[model samples]
Target: MKKIENLRTDYKRDQLNESSLASCPIEQFKLWFNEVLDVIIEPTAMVLSTYSQNKGVSSRVVLLKELQQDGFIFYTNYNSLKSEQIKLNPCVSLLFFWPDFQRQIRINGLVQKISHESSVNYFKKRPRKSQISAWASSQSSVIKDRFVLEALFHDFEKKFKNKTISKPPYWGGYKVVPNSIEFWQGRESRMHDRFLYTKHQNNKWIINRLSP
Candidate 1:
């Protein structure tokens, strides 16, 4: 492997100011989300980090689809390691980085499940195969070979034929209600922009500038 002595990509495109950022985390998140939604391809890809009582810590990239006053929402099997981690320790964090935009968003919060009605609604909206997969496969469980998964998939496909698919009891969405959200924008020579919105005890969000 050859190593290059000097490699640089100058980022002088833009900066995030304290004035432009909202005092509330939700508002600031929406503002930055709107800005990056257009320029970055697959802007929703995020790294969700969670700590489990038995499993310690784990992180995997997943797509974040919904944001609400309560928290950020993403769906997965409740039995998955990540889901189990949230059950043991609700303290969760999400990271979204866009190299093209030279921007990143960090959130720290607690996790909770959404309403059953909401889960059912989201389940019904999934493609037929996904619904079957949700019912067929036991998420995070070990399987012997490809034939095992294939057999389970086809079994569920036949079972759900011409019938309404329901959300699995162990599969649904979890929300990460952020107590703090920090947005980072890379600048020239490493003098970057860092703005953080923190929610206090009384439920008011206070914006502060962090040293970059």
Candidate 2:
């Protein structure tokens, strides 16, 4: 195997400073997100971390579907392991990494299920095959083989043929309301810049510079 220690890259793309940051972290996030859309493939992909009472912490990549003023939204099977963990502990974290830009954003928050109406609205917009697949897959559950899943998909497709596919009750969206958000910008050599925004009492945010 090649020497792992030999792999390294110096980050000199950009610098982030207090003066350059938006007073509101959400505003800053929007700016970065717009930039990410231009340069990053699959910019909506984010790592969601959740804690379970029995499983400790688990993480998986989920696509961000929407960005509301109060939080971020993503949909999934409500019966999945992540959902079970969220039921046990609502606190979760989201991470967005744009390596090509040498930037990352970490959000710590509480997750809550979105309104059924909202879930239905988004579900209605999904492709017919996706809608059928959502009903077929038992996410995070053990399956005997790929054929079993394919069979289930076929069954659902036949059952919903020539009909509107409704959203499965077991699938919906969750919104992550952030309590704190951290932005990181990689710099030349080993030096990096970091800033954290913490929600304070009286509904305001306090921004602080952090050591790399």
Candidate 3:
């Protein structure tokens, strides 16, 4: 068996504190996200992880498409592995690592399907080709080859030619309502700064310092 190793870079960009963080985690996420968005070089992307009760575990790196008070939202086919996992177990974790900023945020939360209205609104904003592709493809399904997928996209494009592309019945968004949020800042050696915000019984957020 191959030996696994711990490979890490030292982090010393900034420090996080309960006093400086926004009372709401989402608000805090927005502030960090905007900073990442502004940096054209080495921009950070979102990493969404899903857990399945039946199929074991799986994860994918998806962009942070949108965010709201309810939770973090992303789109995918209803029959995808992540979707299946969510259907079986609505709990999942999201990790965002901004290497340029030398910071990482880990979120644990319950997942829920978003409303149809919101899905339609986002669908309309996508490029015309993407709209058709969403309608044509059964994401995560076994397929023959690249040509087959391209054919599907092309067929759907032709089918919806002149007409407005509508949201697919099987495709939509999901929100992850965070029960806990952990912020990590790299420091000297392995002594990293860890700030965790856990949800209280009264639905309030309580900040704690976790050993790193």
Candidate 4:
């Protein structure tokens, strides 16, 4: 096997110059996101990091369900560990990495639960099995085994049989309102391109380029 240290990739596919970047980071994100739609699988997947005094830090991959001008949205069980951490500390970080494009985007933000109506609207759109699973799973809870989960799923399945499943009272969405967002592009010889957009007090974005 080849040595891990010997493995390297020199990115030369693209470059992000100030003149070509949008004044609004969200617009820029939409541009790059649309470009990758044809080339990347699960393009909406992002790494969400949350921290609390008790837990220190935790990270997990979560699907990005919606993106608005103000924030990004994702849903989960309210009783989950991440939710508990968020309740204690609302600040969080999000990361989106697309190796195929040698690109990454990092966002730092504050999270808040989105409106119950909005959560229910999104929840109802999910596939029936997924909706049922959301009702059955007590997220982040320890169980005896896989069979226990399977049993719960089957029980919920029958309970909701021939009926419209309602969104669980404890399952909903959170919005991460970003304060800063950084876009990173890998380049040759490790001279990468990095640009950060910070929200100013006036609610305008201040952009700055940093050394790779």
Candidate 5:
């Protein structure tokens, strides 16, 4: 390995402070997200982390589908590994990194499946091919070969030909209701700015500055 520790980048693109932050972390996330729309290739993509007693921890990048006042939303196969882990333990974490802006948002939250109606509505908006793939693939499952997958894809394509494709029962959306949200802004010399917002029992958010 080529001296991995020697590789580094000093971040000084922006600064974050208490006064500049929105009262609600969700609003603050929206502000940061909007600013990165033109700067990042996929501003809405986030790393989702889930844990199960048997499987330990798993993380993967998933595209964000929607943002609600209390939580974030994303869709996936209900039978997938991540979803299975979510069922085992609702507590999960979401991380959004925008290296170009030297900013990251980490959210610790509880995830719950959205209503089937809502999932169906979103499913209808997806491209026809994607809709078919959702039905064709058993996500996170082992398959014999690439041909097996291709064959299934072709079968589904022909099955849904010239017809409205319905959402698969195994595919849906999950919303993560955040209990805590932390925003990090990178600075020079490895010093960074961090702020955390914690939800109180009374339904108010308490903000605190964390040491870098």
Candidate 6:
């Protein structure tokens, strides 16, 4: 087996230049997102990082459900550890790494729960099994064993049988309104291209290229 430290990839897939970038980060993100639609599996998956004063920081992979003009949105159980941390501190970060394109996008922002009506609208489109699972899973809570979870799923399944399942009270979506967004593209010889878009007080985006 090769030594872990000796294993590395010299990325030369692409280069990101200021002239080729969109003035609005969201537009740029959409451009890149559309380009990868056929290349990456689960292209909408992103790493969500949340911080808690007591627990420090935590990171997990979450699916990006919506990319609106202002922010990115995802749904989860309100009683989960991430949600508890978000309640403690609303600031968070999101990261998307597309290895096939040798690219990465980082977003730092504040999170707030999306409107209940919006959540309900999206929830209604979910598959019935997923809706039932949302109700069955307590999320981030500990249980004795697999049987306990399976039992809970079975119970909810029976309860919601032949009926439309509704979104749980503690389940919803959160939108991340970004203040700063960075796009990185890998280049040859360990040199990479990075562009950062920071929202100014006037609500305009200021783009800057960073040394890489």
Local accuracy of candidate 5 as per-residue lDDT tens digits, 1-212: 76998988999888998889999999999999999998779999999999999999999999999999989999999999999999899999999999999998999999999999999999999999999999989999999999999999999999989999999999999999999999999999978999999999998999999999
Q: Residue 93: error of model 2 in Å? A: 0.4
Better of 1 and 2 by lDDT: 2
Worst 10 residues of 1 by lDDT: 1-10
lDDT at 189, model 1: 92
**Tens digits of per-residue lDDT for model 4 on 1-212?**
99999998999999999999999899989989999988999999999999999988999999999999999999999999999999999999999999999999999999999999999999989999999999779999999999999999999999999999999999999999999999999999999999999999999999999999
* Candidate 5 wrong stretches, greater than 4 Å: none
Model 1 lDDT on a 0 to 1 scale: 0.87
Cα miss at 22, model 2 (Å)?
A: 0.9
Q: What are the models' TM-scores?
A: 0.93, 0.98, 0.91, 0.99, 0.98, 0.99
RMSD of every prediction: 1.7, 0.8, 2.8, 0.6, 0.9, 0.7
Q: How close is candidate 6 to the true structure, as a TM-score?
A: 0.99
Assess each prediction's global lDDT (C-alpha) against the native. 0.87, 0.95, 0.82, 0.95, 0.95, 0.96
Clashing pairs in 6: none
Worst 10 residues of 6 by lDDT: 10-19
| Error of model 3, residue 77, in angstroms | 1.0
Q: Give the Cα error of residue 80 in candidate 1, in Å.
A: 0.7
Q: How many clashes in each structure?
A: 0, 0, 1, 0, 0, 0
Q: What is the lDDT of residue 110 in candidate 3?
A: 95
Q: Residue-wise lDDT of candidate 1 within 20-102, one digit each (tens)?
A: 77767787778878888888898889899999768888999878868887688899999988987887899999999989888
Minimal lDDT window, size 10, model 3: 1-10
Please report the TM-score between candidate 4 and the true structure: 0.99
